[model samples]
Target: MSVFSDIFFGGLFQGSLYAMMAVGLALVWTTIGVFNFSHGVFMMLGAYFAWQLVAFGLPVVIAFPLAVIVMAGAGWILQASVVRPLIGRPNIVLVVVITTLAAGSLIENGALTVWGPRSKQLPSLIEGNTTIAGVGVSLHQIAIIVITPLILAALWSFLNRTRLGLALRAVAQNEDASQLVGLNVTALYGLAFAIAASLAGLAGIFMGGYRFMNPSMGADPLLKALIVVVFGGISSISGPIFAAYLIGFFEAASNYYFGLYWTPALLFLVLIATLMVRPEGIFASRSRGLA
Candidate 1:
């Protein structure tokens, strides 16, 4: 029972975090039709930004939100400076994958130079532990579990209920048509990046509180998120969220039964099998436009 509890709660916690990270990756893919390889670095940067703010004696409440805001700006700058200029180029998707990979490396090095390869952690939003169904769990873990759904809900509302969201969706559906309709495609592109970055930033804060963080910490989460995005489906938000939880449970079980070192290999094997079965993703939406 204790072991079961651990796996259950552990998978739930991991699922929530993966959902947070993978959704942002899916958003960028759906919006711009390309992956932002630097996204994991964006998560790392967000954590550092919060850590720096807290180091200066700010409260977690202030630091966390400020970190998210800073990440939004960073995302916008990334799109405007690097991605936007490459628009309309032949084979833009291939170009973007290369450029963003380079950009991710540059940002990771920058974090290493500034943070000096040391691991850092954030103060927990709620410190202490509580028992659930005869199992001990950190309150912080419960908080992450509770808060993630809220964040995703708010994001869903923002993307589905607002005028700006409608415009963004329009751009995602057809950039040329959106431009023809006076939707300001370039600005929407930046907005997409901004939103994706902010989500990644929030995910970073969650991870920082969950475990120690380092410059390269984002790499693992990034890889996992990519797998989730690919396995879940890149065409819509729901796909990644569903995939996150499934993979989360699978990972927890694998870690328990197989050990940590073998988990990644198992995941890749599952991914390979999944791809062999469904190349378009398991939950990939038939109807698109970020829906």
Candidate 2:
């Protein structure tokens, strides 16, 4: 019973974090019609920025928002300058590869130049532990668990209720039609990228509490985000969230029963099985926009 509780609660904690990261990646892909390979760098930048701010005596509350705002600005700049130039080009694949490689190089070298090659840690917002139904958990972990759903809910409301949100959805559905209807498609794309980058920033801040931040820290979340996006279905918003929790639970269970070495293998097997059973994802039908 204790083991089960640990796995269940622990998986939920980690899964929620992954969902935050994956949702941002999905948003960029679905709304802007570009697969942002540099998303991992955005996350890395957020973590590093938060660390730097906090080190300068800023509160976590202030630092988090600052990091997000900076990343949002960076996203806007990237869209306006680099991505926009390739918009009408016939070879989108080449553009994607070039952008990704450029982003990778920029992030790595920028971090090394700015912060040097060292791992940094952000202070936890919530300290100590709490118990639930006789299960013990860290307060920081609980904050992560709570924040994930709140962010998701906020995003859902924004995308479904606001005028700008509706415009974004329209742009995602058909850029040409959206432009014909007087929507500034380019601005919408920039907004989408900004929102996505903001979400990634939040994920980075949360990640810093639990893990050390370095240039390479983004790699794990990047891989996990890709898996969750694929497993959940690219076109569906809720799919990646569900898939994240599922993968988290599977990882916890594998670690508990078979030891740490087999965890990756187990997860890959589950991914294979999931693909075989539901290639379109378990919640693929709920996908918004064109099918």
Candidate 3:
């Protein structure tokens, strides 16, 4: 019973974090029709930035916002300078992808030089563990579990209520149409990139605190986010969250029965099997032309 409880809550917490990490990527993918391969790089940057701030004597709370701001600014600047100009090129999607990939490599190498190969541990927001359903859990995990829904709710409201978020969505639906209505599509794309980068960075902050920071840490999160995005449906905001929980449940089950060594293989298998059934994703309303 205790082991089952552990798996349940553990999977839930882990899935929620996966959703959080994937949310930013979903935004950019749905809006711009391009996946920022370097999404994980920004997450890595956020963790490192926060670590540095804490080392410099800032309180953890203060360090978080500063790191988010710095990363968000960088995201916005990169979109403006590097990505914006390639908007109309032939095979722009491929070009942007390669650019972001290159950027990611550069960022990773830079982090290696600056932070070295040694991984850094982040101080937890709240010390100690608490009991849940007869199992002990870290406060960070519990916080992640609780915080994810709130974040999702806030995101839902932002996209549905705020003028800016609506504008971004409109641009996503029809860039030319949005421009026809006098919306600045380029500006909307930049804003989308900034928001996506900010969310990824914020996720990184919690992740670093829960685990340890390393230059290569972003790759796993990025891959998971891609899977969740595809599984959930690019067109629906709720898709990533739902898919994340489902994957989390499956992962927990695999961990309990199959052991750690088998988890990765199982995840890939699940990805492949699901893609075979619904390449457009479970949440997509219509086929994305996979057939």
Most accurate candidate by lDDT = 1
Please give the range of 10 consecutive residues that has the lowest summed lDDT in model 3: 282-291
Whole-model lDDT for model 3 versus the true structure? 0.86
Off by over 4 Å in 3: 287-291
Q: How many clashes in each structure?
A: 0, 0, 0
How far in Å is the alpha carbon of 117 misplaced in model 1?
1.6
Residue-by-residue lDDT tens digits, candidate 2, 1-291: 788898999799879978988888888778876778777887888888888888889988888889889989887887777677788787875787688769767876889899988788888869898888678988888989988999898888888999998898888778899999999988888998888878887888888887788887777787888888878887757788888888888778888899999887777787788778977666677444433
True lDDT of residue 157, candidate 1 = 92
- Mind giving the per-residue lDDT tens digits that candidate 3 earns over 45-137? 988998999999999889988998888887888788668888878788898889999989999999999999998988886788989789988
Ranking according to TM-score, highest score first? 1, 3, 2
Off by over 4 Å in 1: 286-291
- Which predicted model would earn the best TM-score? 1
Clash pairs, model 3 backbone: none
Tens-digit per-residue lDDT, 33-87, candidate 1: 8889998999999999999999999999999999999999999999987799998
Candidate 2, run of 10 with poorest lDDT: 282-291
In angstroms, how far off is 194's CA in candidate 2?
0.9
Per-residue lDDT, model 2, residue 58, is: 90
| Every candidate's lDDT | 0.91, 0.82, 0.86
Prediction RMSDs, each to the true structure: 1.9, 2.1, 1.6
| TM-score on alpha carbons, each prediction | 0.96, 0.93, 0.95
lDDT for 275 in candidate 3 is: 82
